[model samples]
Target: MTKAANFIWYELMTSDPAGAAAFYGAVVGWTIAGGADPQAGGVDYRMIGRRDGGNAGGVLALNADMLAGGARPCWMGYLHVADVDAAIAAIEADGGVVHMPATDLSVGRIAMLSDPQGATFYIMDPIPPAGAEDMESDVFSVTEAQHVRWNELATSDPDAAIAFYRRHFGWGQDGAMEMGELGSYRFVQRGDVMLGAVMPLMPGMPAPAWSYYIGVDDIDRAAAAVTANGGTITNEPMEIPGGEFAMNAVDPQGAAVGFVGPRGG
Candidate 1:
């Protein structure tokens, strides 16, 4: 099936927006812009933009009202779908559950969901996308604009999860990356470029979950930002077999995040 929507925005609902903002800002060299005013009940969020004016992302304040409403600290990415209603139906038919029904935001219509294994994401209609290219510009930076780029889900059952996305998102192409000890990661692609990787947990990992990546200039310094901002370094910066560098860290809210650079970001 055709990938009608692109993931344009990712809002992490976690405690400590200020700290989260600082962590991500330093890691990705992202500039945090003014957010919507507070008196209106909107989040004390920030617009995360690439340093070189490449692309823009978002951040939100995680609060008690959110957790009280069953919200967990997690990364929520938005998929730009042409028809949000149809996408919602497809997800439901494919064993996913809709946590929040289709709701129209100032941008477009969106519906939050969880895959059969509980990985969460949202299907939406982006407000003013020129096309996939512009949507990509909005979703991630230029260096990150691949056929399918951004969020990768690490699951317990890669094969089954791949089959699920194939049916649900109808991805046209894909390939696999062998992560020495972890296992072979089968990517769900929109075309030639990999949108995300479906990695099965190696051992002792309780459940399948999703992790997000942001392109940066320096992984070493970025990893340090995690610790500086009251976060924990899950994985130190290391050179992936290929020509890239990356590190994994836990945000203040305990959500996992990854920072990738061209060899040494």
Candidate 2:
């Protein structure tokens, strides 16, 4: 199968790795393990493992150097591309900015980037694991709890954002929803699979950003767990299409996140 240009990994950079691990484990039901190990360059990096199997993402210790450099507690998505250098050039040509140029890592080459609207993410050309035929799928199905279920983008210029991605990543318009005064909610897809949507940033929203939604078994229960664990529920569970519910929230370390699942409250 041809590798699609998609989000291949997700990560959270936070000031309190232990606090974040405890909070998200309770809220998302992920098994957080390993910390301050010599294996991770001795930087206190930890893995966010899903209950079902495989790693869901990672949590990196936010150090003083990063904090001095204006880095805050935030969630970042790593996009998979065939060529990192080529993707960087395309991004620059499209009015996007490159925060970090392509650099080699143990896993692959990565470049930190932001859209024309200033929504930051990573673009990477990953090295396949030993004995694996190909890189595992990064985005997960909606039916599975404890995995990424949706990818959403809120940009100042939705039309321009959509065009930029389509031009660079080969994404297509699957469908759209009219949002009255808020403009159109456009669904973006690769081939027949709908990955996510782009919409105009609502008033009071920080910067143009991508919010990933993780699947949960019970929306109400998860929302409660979020609050109980020191995370804030920014948006309560609300019904969406297909009888599932969705919500917006902030993790304990302050990374914005989303959740989707069956409604109970």
Candidate 3:
């Protein structure tokens, strides 16, 4: 079983599920399948399946009720926890806020939460299917082409945000990169694996949030697909530390997603 405090599941809550499916399907090469989730009162819920086989994430359509309540299209990260209630208590004590209380579900207990610095994510005590391995083990691995490659946070207070997560998820600083006037980009780890980094939010960016990078085979091709499929490339493709190229984009429904891959012509 995968240990607690690791990223397990991902979800995109969008106003236009079909549009999101179409846009992401072309950009990331994911096949959107699956029917409505019965537990969700038969709301249209789709699975993002990778080309190599296995689910990457899910898409949940935001209905009129959700939109009326101010729900917007966004990608949410799920961090595994051993006890959702206990985690909630710790989070509250550490200046975090609960957007949704812990609730029972088919998979496990889950709660929507925002860290002290206001980056939203979920904490789930996931229940793997019968005869299956830990959900985290199957869903999150570097070798998988479509897996989430990184969890990047752009926040107003990186130091305080890193400290809050270090206490909650046992994430530690691995290294730091000086960004001159923008301050430092600090890498974070859960044990020995370097998951991602935290940096100060760029001016004019939306409120503090976590941006997940999806792995791809070619960065330039994916960026082009993003624009061609009705999405906007918010940032030009750039080289990262491990020789990978990456870029950020907004889907047609306005959800932010990142792509990481080799440079393409």
Candidates sorted by lDDT, best first: 3, 2, 1
Q: Which clashing pairs does model 2 show? A: none
User: How many residue pairs clash in each candidate at the backbone level?
Assistant: 6, 0, 0
- All candidates' TM-scores? 0.85, 0.94, 0.94
- Report the C-alpha lDDT of model 1 over 5-63, residue by residue, as the tens digit: 44667766667666666776666656665565443246576665665574455666666
Across residues 65-113, which tens digit of lDDT does each residue of candidate 2 receive? 9899998998888988989998898789879999989998777899999
Candidate 2 vs. true structure, TM-score: 0.94
Give the Cα-based TM-score of candidate 3 against the true structure.
Answer: 0.94
Provide the global lDDT of candidate 1 against the true structure. 0.68
Q: Which stretches of candidate 3 lie over 4 Å from their true place?
A: 1-4, 38-41, 133-135
**Predicted structure 2: lDDT:** 0.85
Question: Candidates' lDDT values, in order?
Answer: 0.68, 0.85, 0.85
Root-mean-square deviation of Cα positions for candidate 2 versus the true structure, in angstroms: 2.0
- Candidate 1 lDDT at 19 equals 65
